[model samples]
Target: MNREQPDPPAGGDRIRQTAVRAGGDVIGKKVEHHHPAGPVTALHALPTPPAGFTGRDALLEELLAAVDPTTGADRAGVVVSAVAGMGGVGKTALALAVGAAARQRGWFCAELFVDLRGHTPGAQPVDANAALDTLLRALGVDVEKIPPALEERAAFYRSALAALSDRDEHRRPVLVVADNAAAVEQVRPLLPGPGGHRLLVTSRSTLHSLAGARRIDVDVLTPKAAVALLAAILGADDSRSGRTEELAEVARWCGYLPLALEISAALLVRAPHLDPARLARRLAQEGRRLERLDDGERTVRAVFDLSVQRLTPGQARVFALLGVNPGPDIATEAAAVLTGLEAEEAEEVLQDLAGARLLTSHPGGRWSMHDLLTDHARHHLTHHTGTEVEAARRRLLDHYTRLTADAAIHLQALPGEAVPATFTGTADALAWLDTEFPNLSAAAYAAQHAGHTDIAVALPLDLGVHLDRRRRFDELISLSTLARDTARTTGRTKAEAAAWNNLGAALAGVRRFQEAIEAHTTARTLYQQTGDRHREANAVNSLGAAFLEARRFEEAVQAYTTARTLHQESGDRRREAAAVNSLGLALAGVRRFEEAVQVHTTARALFREAGDRHGEAMALDSLGTGPGGVG
Candidate 1:
């Protein structure tokens, strides 16, 4: 440590001056600056303590990869590693150690630590702007000049950190550590310029949601590391003097948790007269039972419990309900339904949990708790009453009901067909539909079992348009089967007919002509049974299309003629035009061009009268000439 005092600044000069940095650590040099404010929170201490800090080697590699010159055309910019893991798993310890190691290797000019207090549980997370204020003031920025808005504060933080980084690009470098981050959003504001600054963040969960962020998941220290840490704290000579079992027992009892080891060592230091073997026996008796090892008021469980208490009733409900959410991660939309809150509110809650380092957000915006945290949260919220569970299920069902209905209406809109304006948002509704497709199928299946027959039948009908757009014919077929089964169960002839029509369309799109014809024939039977003559004609028309694709013109013409008679009798001009167009094509295929032309001419006239431009265009293209020309 440098013993020389920092040079005193001139009187009345409020702009406290500090070293901007000139690359590489200046050994034994102390930066002279007037800190405009008192230190906010002295970091827990440098990484001088002994800890194994397991599972971070892979994380360090990821961080290095981000700044690897080969990436992004071989340029140099500081790589950001959000060191996230469960509480008491040594995020801060790992970060401090890495910073110290970087300094020893001359990779940085200096290192600074900022605790964002993201995991303080009951305490509100430190605002981004406030963190900036502390950092800027610490770096010699005037306290009164700090920006109030979070965005502006962030800009200033980047600029200030960048100035030091730029100073390092040519000479030495300074790496900054912003630890205990609350969320990606909070950290995003403080990220140094994509230049020389290396940021290492430690949190309780992975920060994979941050684009380009390198994630390091910290777990308990290895037993070897734990023993090493014990020896470091309790004295290596004393530890190895034929009483190693105490250290090993202490390490094991602490779950190899570094923080717990430190506390245990503190206890040992204060009670040196106590026998080591007796201490080991005491710890052993507390097997798997975590005693409150808080130093007066700071215990790991207390820290996490406070955060849990800060969650809303709905958020708390989701945190508990998701204990049973089976998967690696659950999408935001599914989580929203799992909780009773609206999608937006549920998303906000997830953001809160993510910021608090209780959850990890993934690509495509799904989130999950760390394995350790997940297990603990499940244990924490085990008091969910039976009534609460039922209420949650009801909310979930309600959410799916509106979601599926909205999807159905949108599907109807695909052919520019009019559907009721039931849903308030089209974009969000469609996205929800897309993200929840599998869950929707499962829900539909469950609904059918629960006697929600129409819901089971209609959801697939709603998704038909978009799924067709993606050419998911197999999924469409599966959906149609559910609809058909539900309709049969409920004795709903119209729904059954609709299911057949959907099935036929899916089969036709995939060129499964025989299956397509069978589906259409089934739809025709159901439509006729319901006395929906025009619908029956439409089914016949679909069968004609399948036959046409299969090169069965005679069968195609027979189906088209039957459809045309029904359309003409019903005065359904659009259906009449379609039937005529099909009949003409069937005739043309059979080398009867004259009849084909005549039929197409009649179809074109009807399409024009109906004001259907697309239909009229098709009709005009079909005759292949004007009224008097050849087909």
Candidate 2:
């Protein structure tokens, strides 16, 4: 047994030796460890602010206060501020100004800027996912490491922002300026969670649904601010041309809107010696204002067109109608009338327009469009609205004509007048006319140009008495001229006669006696040719007034005599009373006081028969007072 143990021990030694050698071989292999590289530094990726950027100090301060990373130590999420307004209202300019200022103040370690292209003329808006991919690459993340899914990428982006803030020994901040963001979804994923980061978003949309965002609305520049901006753009030499009044006129014509002012200033710079007064004169024409406020690459109208192009079909139709609207602003009820929708339905469309920044809402449920936007809308009305524009124009004009005719009945009525059901009383009628006077004037001209001959003829005919009451003589003349031309083109004989009569009245109001006589003569001939005895009598009365104005007393007497006879034949007692009163004036002009008194006495009786108490009172006063007879 002793001999066997000794032999095994000797064998076990070799095995032990081999095991030791294997252990040594394993221990001999080299060992290695890896660690991640340090974070990137010095990121500066913001576009330069526009040259000569001026104004918006108050807005800049608000933006700076909202986006200041230093003040919100307890806050963890990124601060977001939305700058919104109509296109070309300086939202981008204000945003750029804030970004440049923040960068200069050393408030950020990295900066990012992107144009969302939400309202670009011919391009689609940039996808938020793709925009994130680009942003990740900019932040020094490897392209391969970026996740393929949008949600994953967005998660990774937030992590990266958190990691960057954490890794930085100095605790530097990041700034992002998202330009032209179309909607909330496009910007939601890009925002950083509670951290040392801030976002500034600028858009043509109000972006009201963007959660937790500080909203800033940009409006048209104040007149002084606008003029100063123009001066800044045009330089001291061009702006100080001893034509400050003209410069101010130019600013007003531009609607005190920045894009228009900038474009006009640029035009002035290019032409140098083109007097500001001349430019103002050109812009004074509303039809040509947009044309003059355009450069080759950019235009106020083009900018506004892009904003309109983004509207929904219903919203687009309303926008087009707004362009054709003749007033400075529109109430919800009036807008309803224009769109042929219920007031509530039209109000919803108006809210959509306001949200898109295509229209601005004022107090009292009213809305206004920018001057340039109106021009662009009109352009769309001409090209995009197609045949619907004609129907729309007719509806618009009919609404105005019917309402105005009703109002005229309360103010002053002719024979055979029918009141519109819309008018409840004289006060209501006058209030409507007062509110719609400007639009009524604009509708007449718009109808004439749009080839709505019937509307053109009816609008001025119904609105003329209101215009006369307001002493809007120039506008009256313009409406009358347009109506006359439209009536002639459409071969509406009675409309032509009415147009000529209104034109004669308007011309007389403006002291153009000779032109007034010609217009009245043409009206009389047309009315007589059409065998419209009542209207012919009215035309003859108008001709007699023109003769009296021209000091041709004998011709005035003859015209008034013919008008009185025609009114008697037509059984228009009211107009016969008016003609007799005019005959009394002509007789008085010819120094026949006794004949004037007799004529006035007969006129008073006719006025009473016609139930015109005011006409009777005027005739009584005329009979008592010699030189000032009423007609």
- Per-residue alpha-carbon lDDT of candidate 2 for residues 1-631, written as tens digits (9 for 90 to 100): 0000000101111110000001001000000011233333325767666555676778779888777888865222222333343567777778888888888888877777766766643234656876776577568764335564678889998887777767777777787777877877788888877776887787767666767777778777777777778788777666454456777887777777676676566556656677777776666544254565444213355435444554678888899877757656778887888888899999999987775556777767988765556666777777554667666667777777777766665554333344456777555776688667657766776676666777777777666655544434456677777777887988987777777777776676556889988988998899779986766777787788778767788998999899889878977676678778768877988888889888989988988997767667767766655454333
* Window of ten residues with lowest summed lDDT in model 2: 17-26
Model 1, 1-631: lDDT tens per residue? 1111112222222211111001111001111112233323222224352343444566555555543323332222232332343466666656666766666566655566666767643233555665666567556554435554567778887787666556554544446677777676667666665655656666655666765555556666777777777676666556342466767776676667765565565445546675556555555554423445533123344334434555676666667776544333567777877765677888888876665556767668788665445655666656787676656554555566676665545432323444446554445555666566655655666566655576777666655554543334556778888888888878978777767776776676556779978987998898889897866777777777777767787897898888899888878776688678768877777777889888889988987886666667767776763222345
Instruction: Name the TM-score of candidate 2.
Output: 0.52
For candidate 2, what is the total of clashing residue pairs? 4
What is the clash count for each candidate, in the order shown?
15, 4
Q: Candidate 2 — which pairs collide? A: 76-194, 76-195, 77-193, 77-194
Give me the candidate number with maximum lDDT.
Answer: 2
Give the number of the best model, judged by TM-score: 2
In Å, residue 554's CA in model 1 sits off its true spot by: 1.4
TM-score, one value per model: 0.50, 0.52
Off by over 4 Å in 1: 1-314, 322-338, 342-345, 356-359, 362-391, 401-404, 407-435, 449-451, 623-631
